[model samples]
Target: MTDQPQVSAEKPSEASADQAAPTPEAEAIAAYLLKHPEFFVEHEELLTTLRIPHQRGDTVSLVERQLKLLRDRNIEMRHRLSQLMDVARDNDRLFDKTRRLMLALIDASSLEEVVIAVEDSLRQEFQVPFVSLILFSEKPLPVGRWVSTEDAQKAIGGLISDEKIVCGVLREHELAFLYGAEQGEHVGSSAVVALTHQGLHGVLAIGSRDPQYYKSSVGTLFLSYIAEVLGRVLPRFTQSSRPVY
Candidate 1:
């Protein structure tokens, strides 16, 4: 055992230790700064001293970076606010149009007047390009496009099967039936709602040239409401004529 003396393992150098891990003092300072966000306000000189690396590989003072961050946030907020204002203005216009349409529908005396009111309001007031209102009847009516119940079922039975509103790109045949052959070819999307009160009165469908316009039911509330109103009102006029089921 006395032939060889034991040698202790060499300890890591100070430079290696420093490079391996941050000192506790630096970590404590960081933690304290986080806990006291107003620390910079008290020590204004530190703001000029602290630097943040920029995307361009240049360093910017903490104050400049903070100002940039604040400016970016302000711009984003302004953009969001502008969008909200636009939506509000659009809703106001929609409300006014809807009010006018309701009045016209209420004032209508005859079936022809009713048909005229809806078509005119939709085309002129609502600015809808393509509008269709088909009434189902066994016999030809004096006003509006009248399709026999059997024919209506044959053409668009799936659309009028329920009271819920339907929206999206329709098949070529459906588009033709709702908007007509030539006009339907130009229509990219459509929204349809069945008029049902005591019975299935008819179908109300609107079309847009933009394919994405009526892709969903997001903006079809007014269409559905108008259809509901027509359903209830049409029954009053059709009682004598007897609109088929």
Candidate 2:
């Protein structure tokens, strides 16, 4: 048979030399993810792409190492989130508990009850182990002295002693809070705040086991609140506690 004349066909235009070409490795990586985005993303893909045989122990070792690192980071993130959740829950409980107890403290019927309430509240609020409350009065007569401290009744029965600590308080409202002042028998580092209204006046003492618990420039909102409650409650106690003439 006679050979037919070859038909000439125009060649398609080629891309400019300056144009960049996508590498086969990049295309392979994209296809691997597109086919199995989740299951193939981790260490196993490293071996699969490299076409490492099952007999190659070195490839398996490297894959295990990378997987362990990812697992550790995931565990650390979960642990940190758990700790933050616990802290949020604890703070919520504390604010609610403190607000309730403080309200109960304000309703105390007597000075002793007030002190007990204050001590309990402080222990719960601030996490202190121990607490005490003292009231100082220049009532023209020593009040809350023998009555509060029965053991000191015999010693104080002799009117007044030169060694008594009352001299410092009535020395004037000069000292607001005494942290660790030497006060003979009543000797604990205490938060001494004043409470006064017209004719009836006194200082309130709040003490704890730790010496550093109370400081000089500490804000007195809670202390002042207790003092105000005491002013209201003391009147009722005084009328009921007065000796029959």
Candidate 3:
């Protein structure tokens, strides 16, 4: 008879059992905290023990951290509100100036008078350093800085797109065409507003000696509005007769 040896099962050691047990991961803990908002109320002592790092290299309690975040948000909101208020004030002033200019244009009976009114108001009221108006029509207008449509196109056709307002430093050729060579040399930046109504096409050019006076990023709402007003009013002055260039 052959005798078979008996097999015995041994229990796992305490150290091995402890090592095999699953530990809670940081992500799982975070998820649990998010899912159970009331967990903080149950264990409020953790709020005093937990520390968060601040930009100033100081650690703060959870309550203090929350207060800091609220303060930062409040400051940001206040700054944004101040900027909005400033913009509103500026818009109000511009509206008043535009109203006065509109009245002046309406009162002028002749094209020459309208031109004078625009130039004077732009200089005195709007504080524009340099201004020029170029009308494109066959009808003869009072002799001034008026140039033929062909001349104007050759000078600034590429700059203007439909009725869009162009703002930035103008090219040497464009600058010279809008302003005289002597005046152009002094202008560092400019805004050119295109005007079109019926069969009339023209441009109102404003120049400044300061390079930053007119920025490309600046809004052209007021300039476009003025151009629209001019387009409507200036056409009334032009006659059917061909203008002698």
Candidate 4:
């Protein structure tokens, strides 16, 4: 099972509760990923292993440079971000019963607003007990008073300090489904995106408390959509509208 950062008020699942604590492979893989999350995008060799399509890779290459692939509306780019935006919009409309909730999710005018909106929408969409939205920067956030799970934070913090992982996962799976029950060895699973400040993209962490949650075998197209949306929104918020004197 993956050791996803479980934040929020939910509990871990029964099957997850029963499984033993992190195995060497699971721990190593998680740690390795945390350190080199860029491997998700940068390492060309691991692209196939991660199942990132070649066309998507090339598209990402162009997207990272902020080049709108308008070469052919008739012939879409290998990976179409417009398609992903359509998914996000549909997701927003589907889950939100009222219009205000939908507006709150997308009317984000700043990074903090974006984080809060994403935390709510994504946790609900992924059916997770807890979730968080993290903004990565060369500068660190003043040590926030809360640490979701002490142990998970410790492991992740270590990797971050050593530059092992790219960004932190904000929710825990173990607690999501296991609430009001027992303390299990297994914990939350996570859906991760590498939030690169340089690339103008941020990670979208969707976590679950179920043992059967996110697997290495699963695809992350939706999570990619989430990241892509944030990538577009954040800069607009930061760009000053006032004229430079």
Give the winner by lDDT. 1
Compute the lDDT for candidate 1.
Answer: 0.84
Which portions of model 3 miss their true places by more than 4 Å?
1-59, 137-140, 212-217, 240-245
Query: What are the per-model C-alpha RMSD values against the true structure?
Result: 11.7, 14.0, 11.8, 32.2
lDDT of 2 by residue, 78-167 (tens): 999999999788767666655665577567655566556666677777564433343433232233331222222232322122211221
RMSD, candidate 1, Å = 11.7
TM-score of each: 0.76, 0.37, 0.69, 0.36
> In terms of TM-score, which candidate is strongest?
1
Clashing pairs in 3: 138-242, 138-243, 139-243, 140-243
Model 1 misplaced stretches (Cα beyond 4 Å): 1-59, 240-245
Locate the minimum summed-lDDT window of 10 residues in model 2.
167-176
Better of 1 and 3 by TM-score: 1
Candidate 1 per-residue C-alpha lDDT over 20-49 given as tens digits, one digit per residue, 9 for 90 to 100:
576899999989989997776676554455
Ranking by TM-score: 1, 3, 2, 4
Q: For candidate 4, lDDT tens digit of each residue in 71-138?
A: 34335743577788887887676545334434664786655666666665655654555454444333
**Candidate 3 at 165: error in angstroms?**
1.6
Instruction: Kindly report which residue stretches of model 2 are placed more than 4 angstroms away from their true locations once superposed.
Output: 1-56, 59-65, 124-127, 132-245
